[model samples]
Target: MLGTICRFWRDQRGIALILVTIMLPAIIGFALLAIDMSRANNLHNDVQKGADAFAIAAAAELDGAPDAWTRAERAMENLVDNTTRFSNSGLVTLASAGSVTVNPGASSCRSRGNISWCFLKSLPASDSSPITSSNYATTQAETLFVQVTVTPESFSSIFPASFLGGSNGLTVGATAVAGSPGAVVCDMVPVFICNPFPGQSLYEVANSGQFYKKSLKLVVGSTSWGPGNFGFLRPSDGHGYGETDLATDIAIGRVPECVSARRIYTQTGNLTTKVKAAFNTRFDIYANGGGFPSKSDPRWPPAPNVRKGFQYASNGNGQGSGSQNPCNMELATDATRYHQLTRDTSFTGQIGNGGWDYTGYAAANQMTSALTHFGSSYNNTTNPPSRYDLYHWENTHDSNGNVVPVGDPNSLVHTQSVGGETGVPACASTVGDEDRRLIYAAVVDCSDSYVQSQLNGQSGAPPAIGFASLFLTEAVTGDEVMAEIVDIAGSRGRGTMENFVRDDVQLYR
Candidate 1:
């Protein structure tokens, strides 16, 4: 028996089997832990991706509306609730568990009072306090930042680790900031128009008809230095190069002030030459009753009747064979002509009465009537009436049958007393010079102290308020250009917040 025991102890064949049996449970436990770790990592990545998508979607609607916060939160929740993915051997669902914070006018750093300096990289030392959930809301109109935290629904690890004091739950979070980093405007005009409705939103401005009925007086020659003056912009250092250069720069959207140094020049000579050059750069004029011929370049002929020196006459009496007077016809009355005019590249996707509002057209006619037939009886009976009043002619009654006075006119133009030669003349009377009728003008906030100071060449200029498409109904006479504000750029719809001129949205952090 002793000899048999000695031989068995020396044997190594079964020893390997014994060791394998002893280590099998540990190996299986380690494999399970590795798989759980990979699932956790994948969950973290997927949650981050959802957070990023949610932030971008919500950022687009942060246009300073009263319900911006509500919309953003809803967007984040919808994204999380709808996303699902496979993890380990089973599927894992993702959802927003904690609060979704939206910080508007609040930067990734601290407030700098300007949109350009609201990012983390451009922040100054004085404004370097870290942004916290506690103090994120702000009234400044600069940047928008959002933070989202996510927790996966009750995930159980394959291997329980109560003995090793490990938890099975996991949570992840992400943050993003987005805002306009200045706009890159293509074919932007160099002219700047002072905002007529100060301390009001773009929506209010549009609803009030001030956006369509008013004409901006171009600051020229020796106009008084005030808010509504029109002037040439010196976008570069020193005085700007003369007329031709200015037009070329404006056509190509090369105004340096649009990006950095923007200065307005009011005392320059050759104002007519500069304005004409700018207008011609955008339009192709046909003189003496000529019609447009098809060309390779589609952007030519910015407006209808852009050609000058043509007399209005009935069909067979005038140059073209049309029902009404095609030469000097009112575009609003003639639908066919209006459609043809809107086919121009500039009028694509524009707003109002087929991209040209009736309010502006009526205002133009009123200006013409004021100049042509001054002190005539205000005719409220005509279909397209000849009067400065904007109120509907039908009698309006209050609670009692007494005819109530039409409340105050929505626009300043309507309220102005109509008499004398109030109409502004065409930019040029000569043939092929009517292209100035449609000029793009920047609508700037004169109410902002910074903008006002900057206009006078003071230090620290605020960004321009926005841009508008102005229809130069008539020419520049003395110092005024009788133009109707047709459309304000960057306004998504009739009642939305107006974005800054040529501004684009970008992710900062």
Candidate 2:
């Protein structure tokens, strides 16, 4: 019995070595797996971060795209480009790797009265598609939560595929989102830099208008404000409140103290030849009591004054009430009228044997209250270049630095009377030059579907408002972006996508 026990003990001794040998390999395998798995997890985290960064860049670009598909497409290209750009920033700038793209659609003219940013990223394939998660089906969302990803492929810590096989590469992703209670202010500023002023139409915007729907504007002098009675408003945005008080106000609100509009003198000179000649020939003349007692010219339209020229014409929005485009029409026929002629030595330089071939000018002999204030102007030596160049700052000042009125009617100016003198009417449009004060107003060419309705409460309602309203103005550009992505997984993993972290958390629109 003792011998047998001894042999058993010896066998037990070898049992320890055997167990060690067997368990060691298993332990080693597990250890290797844990090490590799940890590495992969770390890499995945890195990729997720990279993806988040790229995705945001893509979405931002898409937001400016003209259409949904375009936004998606641009998102893809932008993501790739951002990758390169960030990569170029050096390895330190971007600590990891992953890709991003957007799936888009479902939102349009969001500011027209909608919530959510217009274009946002969607998913793997198309910009946007039906998606379901957390026992809930997402019917439609303007934008998707952000997508961030991590791929073992970007993991340098792992060498070869290890025991897992294939290539040591793996991919993971996560998505995130940011919300912007965007105001129209985003797209309208670059269009017009307004100049703020104390008086006139532009100053009224902070007081009214739907610019919050599109943008904001500043006023005159806020741009260039010495002495001028008018400022116009409207963006080629069709915010058509030209000369309307609100229009001018909104424009100034947009960009105050802006020196000028983005301008290029592409077209030189005045109105078209046909229009000019027509104005000259049909020019009307009236005799105030100062010139003749109770003599009126039936050929002319109702004259606000006996010896002055203010032109009026039909505005073809032919469908609306009082759809008249009014202006002080200066006719070439009135070029040689008595009280209006440039006579400064510089006049020779200004007219160069030529003259402003436009409407009548008179006022020197009219009584204080006779018919209306009629006044003539001469080439101002105070501001030589502008003597014949139409109204400008220099011409607005007197040789004595007083606020000088348009002496003799040079260019046709809209006007009203105060003292014995008549003040010029407000301008009816934004300077239309990038370097000038930007004006913004909502105006349709009269053919707008809801023209009457949309402008119901607007100033200058044909005749009801009694006068054209004014507002600030500016210019804006149009832009579009699109993308598609794909994902494939075999089995036994959590969604296998860091980019689509489905149910762990609720997603935002």
Off by over 4 Å in 1: 1-31, 61-139, 142-156, 160-170, 182-184, 208-210, 213-216, 220-228, 231-244, 251-272, 280-305, 309-438, 457-460, 475-478, 491-504
- RMSD to the native, candidate 2? 21.6
Question: Model-by-model lDDT, in order?
Answer: 0.42, 0.27
Candidate closest to the true structure, highest TM-score:
1
Per-residue lDDT for 305 in model 2? Answer: 20
Best by lDDT: 1
Compose the digit string of candidate 1's lDDT tens values, residues 265-362. Answer: 32134456445534543333222243222122233333223322122333554333344322233222243222111111122112222122333333
Q: Lowest summed lDDT over 10 consecutive residues: which window, candidate 1?
A: 111-120
Candidate 2 lDDT over 37-62, as tens digits, reads 77556544554455455445434332
Deviation from native of the Cα of residue 205 in model 1, angstroms: 2.4
TM-score of each: 0.51, 0.27
